[model samples]
Target: MRAIVLGGSFAGLLAARVLHDFADEVTILEPDNEQEHRTRSGAPHRDQLHALLAMGHDQLERFLPGLTEELVDAGAHLGHGEQVQFYIDGKRRPTVPGIRMIGASRALIEAHVRRRVLALPRVQVLPHRATGVRTHAGRVYAITSVTPGGDCHELPADFAVDAMGRSSRLGRWLEAAGWPAPRIERLRIELGYATARFHRGHELPDTVVAHSTPGPASNYLPSVCEPGALTAVEGARWDVVLAGYTGYRPTSDPAAFVNRMRRCVAPIQQVADLCAMEAEPTTFHVRDSRRRHFRELPRLPGGLAVLGDALASVNPVYGQGLTLATLQASALHRHLRCGASPHLPATGYFRRAGAVVDAAWQLSTTADLAQPHVTGPYPFGYPLVRWAADRVTQASILDAEINAAFSDVLHMRQHPRVLTRPRVLLRTARTLATHKITRPT
Candidate 1:
């Protein structure tokens, strides 16, 4: 069997890795040169700080064994337990057992993953732009591609994947080929963030990761502390990022960026005061969170599947993109391993991947709705849900057990519904009540 994967970034690389197990030859279509570990021009946010949550870390290890040790040996930090800090409203949440985060830049992570994937003998990369999919009788049989000089060509495949990312042309390609495109749902966020790297050495010795965001005490505004995060990434460098919505969006000014960090959580502030800026701030803006509901389509071309940002692109602040892609790749692997035919539509894969997308969407979009400027196609009963969710967030800061439950959902290891469990809800209510009764006021 032959499989073709479009867009060879994180998601495309993972998809190719999975396809190698079932397909005799798997070709990755990516325009960017992968000869070095530097960020690609196509991915402007590659230099930005990125998170590999506990589940993403586990899946990555599962896909590329010994990668963790490799990363650690190469200087990437693995923050476990207390070293991985999360703060709400300027106060750190209670440390929870089993929590973990990998401190690495997106470039380093993608570079390593790409290297591992390309090392597979069955996989090869084609440096060309994928123009469209060619289908016959409701099944994709070939991919139309073009060269930099405008030469067009076709590659036959038994299976194909669209990992083209947020601005994927797959929907348009499918529509042009007379197929129904997945309906899209979007929530405009107008979020902007900037990341700057600084030389790191012996600073925050016990801390590898720190993230701070507005919460209940500040009414989800940056009144108490500006929302920011930082990690001890490779090359003995600290990668710090500050985020804001609409008018409060971070800027590229190096001094202002550090000043913003000074107002964030202590770890970020410490970095701002202690470390020398390695370079100017790199910025990226997010217009909205988008998801393509493939499962909602009545029919799709066989021998085809979509993954990664091509499926869902949520708020990056939540750090769910990479994990969501890994999970979707796992879903694709399960679908093929179960004897599901590549000659037919990947209904089962879409269904499984949809569940993952839904979970991430619920977690991110719900939080995004908290922003005052973000008008919502609000979820049913959002007011009540928001109240309950805020209480859970507050309680998570106070109770370790509740934090663990909340962390699981935040890290995408478990569904958000886990927070609604009777035990969790009861604990949250009791914790809030106790804290209320013991207030200094």
Candidate 2:
């Protein structure tokens, strides 16, 4: 069997790696030649800080043994959960001591994973842009591509997988081919972000500090890394995103950037003061979250599947994309091992993948909606739930158990069900009561 995967990204590569077990030939078609190194124009935030959740680490280790070591060898930082401090709503929860995570640039992670995938004898990566897909006799027949020399070619395959990022054209192609369009749900979030790197030895006190605005205030989330490097990401709602949103943008004027940091909460200001700007500030647009309900489509072409951002993309702020992609790949592997029907594999994979997306989506959307500037259809009972969540945040400050529970969900180790456990609710109530009693009248 032969398999062709579109988009040579984290998801595409992982899918190809798994397909190697079942397919005689597996080819990855990437549109960009520049991906040979630790830089990708396709992923604008490639240089930004990315932390692999514990669950992601587990999946990588399972799929590719020594993968974590490979990343560490490539200058990635390994830290205990407590090493990274998170301050929410002006309260710093007592850190959970032993959880471990890998922190590195998105490029570094991609580069290392690509190297591993390419080393497999059955896998080949062809640098070319995928223009469209063609099906014949109830099977995906070819992936259309344009070569660098301005020529067109068709690469035939027994199976085709789309792992292209957010701007995938597969949906339109499917429609043009007379297939029903995939169901899509989009959330409009007016989000803007600017990022810059700085020398790491600066006088920063914490490894990570996330300052969140409970209402309309702009917020900053900065990360400290190895090699004497640090990255600061400042964000705001779409309407006020320019100058008024975060009160600052990534500017060549270092003094101005630092001055804006002063407006953030305390620790962020302290970290901002210690470093010299090392890179140019780049700005990008962040719309809302989007998901293509491929599984819901009544008829999908046999031997065709979509994975990664092409299938669904969540808000990047949650740092869940890579982790979820890894989980999806693992799910694909499991589905193949079961010897399910060809059409059933694609449908079953999407059904299972939705559960993973739902966990991350709820966490990210609810948080985004908390911003006063963000507007959307609030589901019935959302306001009451939001109020309860705010109380949980308040309680997390004093209750170590509550903090741990929240962290587990944030890290993707536990499902959202953990949040609704009766013990958590009881503890949250007691903590809130204690906090109120301690306040001076």
Query: Model 2 over residues 185-292: C-alpha lDDT tens digits?
Result: 787765555555555553543453342333211122221110112222222100001111232224435565556555555555555665555654455556667888
**Candidate 1 lDDT, tens digit per residue, 329-353?**
9999999999999999999999999
Off by over 4 Å in 2: 36-39, 202-253, 265-267, 343-345, 437-441
Task: Give the TM-score of each candidate.
Answer: 0.98, 0.87
Query: What is the TM-score (0 to 1) of candidate 2?
Result: 0.87
What global local distance difference test value does model 2 have?
A: 0.68
Query: What are the lDDT scores of the predictions, listed in order?
Result: 0.90, 0.68
